[model samples]
Target chain A: MRDQNRQFRLAKRPEGKPDHDTFDLVETDVPDPGPGEALVRTRYLSVDPYMRGRMSAGESYADPWEVGDPLRGGVVGEVVESNGAGFEAGDIVTGDLQWADYATAPGTALRAVDPDLGPVSTALGVLGMPGRTAYFGVREVAEPGPSDTFVVTGAAGAVGSVAGQIASLAGARVVGFAGSAEKVAFLEDELGFDAGIDYSATDDYGAALDEAAPDGVDAYFDNVGGPITDAVFDRLNVDARVAVCGQISLYNATERPTGPRKLPGLVSKRARVEGFLVGDFAPRFEAATERLAEWVASGDLQYRETVTEGLESAPDAFLGLFEGENVGKQLVRVSEPDE
Target chain B: MRDQNRQFRLAKRPEGKPDHDTFDLVETDVPDPGPGEALVRTRYLSVDPYMRGRMSAGESYADPWEVGDPLRGGVVGEVVESNGAGFEAGDIVTGDLQWADYATAPGTALRAVDPDLGPVSTALGVLGMPGRTAYFGVREVAEPGPSDTFVVTGAAGAVGSVAGQIASLAGARVVGFAGSAEKVAFLEDELGFDAGIDYSATDDYGAALDEAAPDGVDAYFDNVGGPITDAVFDRLNVDARVAVCGQISLYNATERPTGPRKLPGLVSKRARVEGFLVGDFAPRFEAATERLAEWVASGDLQYRETVTEGLESAPDAFLGLFEGENVGKQLVRVSEPDE
Candidate 1:
């Protein structure tokens, strides 16, 4: 194992879309686990679209990443050294940590992952934050009833993909809006989505949405916000529920983009729109994880991952999320775990 | 009583704002009530901002008024003649009826109003649709908790005045945004609002709102939608509730206006925004009326009305609502009932 740890730091705030200059990869002495801490060898580091928000000097869900600070995110790792109780060497764990080859964290922050629960990496994808986000957002926020038409933007993405499946399980007709034809096919053919619209190929989103949701959208799970969300708002049925999970489309915008006013329609339809975070559902995480695992075990839920091999590729992997290069969760594999 | 019924008919749809030409006052011979119907001599006719929507060719909460058809609205009248079982001549009743001195309605549509409920006109003001709208909107939709900083726009208007009072009664710190200093004084002095901002005098709404709500806005009742709403959205606390009762500010917009995007804030704060109509609370209207009456009886609730004296002034009264000419509920007193 390398004696030096390599990590990416926010070098500067980006005006819009971030590039290589936004990050600076630095090497340092491998961190040591202090009392009640564990030294983790990161096997996978999550590269999410939300990370883009932290790279800007603006208000976001999380505090902005200060220039010269190492970036942080969800990391699935194996404990190499420990000075804490309940955690031993070779234990596989997951927690929010630095995007580095190795990270040291409080043992309490790291939750042990059972490899037998179908691949430890699933802890960062379908069995983790993204999965729980989909579960709570769809089941609680959107509340799609049977025979309802559910439309989800960013449908081929981690949270959106899972959200669509949850809507389908609830006996609703699920429709998805994805960026590419391959992603659209993945949603319709592999995931049992009733219909999938390739937003990249469609000029008239309103017309495409009308064709997909002929009866009107009963629930909308919005993972991306822009013109697509505007169209969905226009097609909402009376009492329609909208769950605003993310606005990845605007994360990289230089300025706030205004669109058609939506409040008028909400009043006429008596509809509801809400925004939520996964951290808010921490108390119910165990329940959601159990259900998601069962779905995955029964082949009722499926997931895809786009991974780049090495800590050096983490920046590119994260930037690729904006370019629609990822179908599901984007992660960077720093090393292979011990079998 | 007059032998001919005079009513306003939709002459044509207005391009932007309806003018005198938009209405044609037509006269016809008064007809006798059929079996199970009552001939109601109109006393007070409601001319509200929502009536402006029916005159347009766009979709709204209610159906559009067709060309050459008499406009209909809430009318408090005396049963001049009854061919119905439950109603007697001279019975005071209120129902949705044509804007005329006299019109016939099914007895079932007319609800008998007690003259003892602090003036029967209170049925059209504090004891009526506007009152019930504020009741359900504050209690159910916004759900303001005690000690919450509640902010309401169009705060001196009919529904807003009541909504602010309801929030104050719920033990919240109420702040109001009104169009004039007199209206602001009405909210702060008579209605017990903690603070009132005359939006017309303020150039920076965000700064004004911040000064009023030093902590943050926990609940927002939006009766007017425009730049003022955009500013309140910026100061929303975590888990804030927004009740969108009306968008009177946008009722006469010639074109759809685009404002700053607000969905991104929802994800971080986990806020909820819902639109509602008073009709949605029909099942519990009796309970709301009782509570509202108790409040008014206790002198804890107060209201004001800008009454236009004749039925011929109904069009101008409604148009005045859009112009911010009326302070509270705008009603035309068509006639006085025989004591």
Candidate 2:
């Protein structure tokens, strides 16, 4: 075990879009844990769209990662050492353990990462927050009724891919929008989506959406909010429900993207659009994750992990989210499990 | 009675927006009704923004007015003679009377107009359908919880003007938006409103909206759907309810208006925007109207009527709705009450 920790901290606050200069990788002596805290050897790290929001200094869902402070998100690791806490050495646990080789945290935040349900690393993907997000949005927000059509953007992504499958399981007709032909094919062919549209080559999203969803949309689970979302608004059926989960497309934009008007549509159609943060449902999270884990075990839910091999590549993995490089959930392996 | 009935019919379907040439007025002999029908002598006529959509030869909430046929809408009149049906002579009623001197309607479509309810002319304005629209929207659609702030646009117009008063009676902080200073003052001084904004003088709507509704909007009753509507969206607090009743702002535009880009906000804010048609509430329309009439009689709900005297002036009265001419409700006086 190393006596030092390698940390990646926010070097400076990003004004608009972030680049390489915003992060600073630093090495420091590993500190001893206080009572009730355990030192964990991180093996996997979670990178998500929400972390980008935390990089800015202001009010956000997650506390902003201040300049010179180590960045933290969902991490799965075995406890190397503990200060008389419930966690023991060799016990695998998960929590927000930062972008570091080793992290010390209170025992309360840690959850036992059960490997038999699926790969332990999946605690950051299918069996974790992203999976729970898809569950809450599908079951709580949209709640697709009989023979309803569910439209999802970023259909081949972590939250979206899971959302489509769950929506289908709930007896809804599932359609997805993706940026590439390959993703569109993957979503439709491999994932059991009723329909998929390649938004990359489609210039007129309104017409393409019309062709894809001829009957009009009943519920929209939006991951990318821009013109594509506006196009969906134009074709929304009366009394439709919209779950605004993420705006990955607009997160990095220098200014707010301007698109076709929506207030009239909101009034004329009497449809509903709502935003949600997954963490709000954290109290009932285990209930969602347990079902997701069971679904994956029963083959009712399938997930693809876009894995980056090493902890050193975590920055690249984080940046890839904005570029849409991830097919499903994106995670980085900090260390190999003892075989 | 004259044998010839003067009728205003659709001359041509408007491809974009309506013009003078789109409507044609003609003279024809009044047609006699068959069984279960009553011949209605048109006395008062309704000219509203919703009629513009009925003029188009396409699918909408209401059926389109066919070319060479008499245009039809809500008409208040007396039953001169009943064709072996329920209606009797001197029976004041409201029904789908065409834009002509006399109309033949099935007994199912007609309702006896109560002469004791203020002015029978008010059946065409406040204390009537528009008033009912306000009552139901505030009580049902935009159900403002206590401490909720209700914001309305096109605040001086019929539906919105009434909505503000009803919201205030329901113990909501009412803020309104209108085109002119005089109208804004009327909303604040004469009508019961917490705040009023003159949209014409305010160059930056977002800032002005933020100023007026600094605490944030909890409910929005939208009558106009343009830039002003967009501004309301940005100022909405989390979990806000938006009742989109009408979009008079876009009624005359040749193309769809370009304004606020809101799907992103919808996603981030978790708000619900729903569209509704008053006709859909048929199961409870009488219940709503009864309560509204009671409120008006109690002097709890006040109203204004922009009466354009004579059926020949009905076209100009309707056109006046888009121009913000009607203070409360715009109607045409087809006959003198004593006549």
Model 2 CA deviation exceeding 4 Å by range: A57-60, A84-86, A206-211, B13-19, B57-59
> What lDDT score belongs to each candidate, Candidate 1 first?
0.91, 0.83
What does candidate 1's lDDT look like per residue over B1-339, in tens digits? 887889889999988878889988988878789998999999999987788889997999999999999999998989989996379988999999999989999988999998887778878878999999999999998988897999999899889999999998899999999999999899889999999999989789999988999999999999888899999999999999999998988887899978989898888889999999899889998888888999999999998888998889988898888888998888899997653
Candidate 1 Cα errors over 4 Å, as ranges: none
Q: Which candidate leads the pack in lDDT? A: 1
TM-score of predicted structure 1: 0.99
> What's model 2's TM-score?
0.94
TM per prediction: 0.99, 0.94
Cα lDDT tens digits for candidate 2, B1-339: 767788888888777667677778888888788788888888889887888888876555677777887888789988877887698988988877798888888878888888898778777667667777787787888877669899998888888888998898888999999889899889988888888999889879888877787888999998888778777887888778888888888866666677645766665466777777776676887787787788788888888877888878878887778788878888888776566
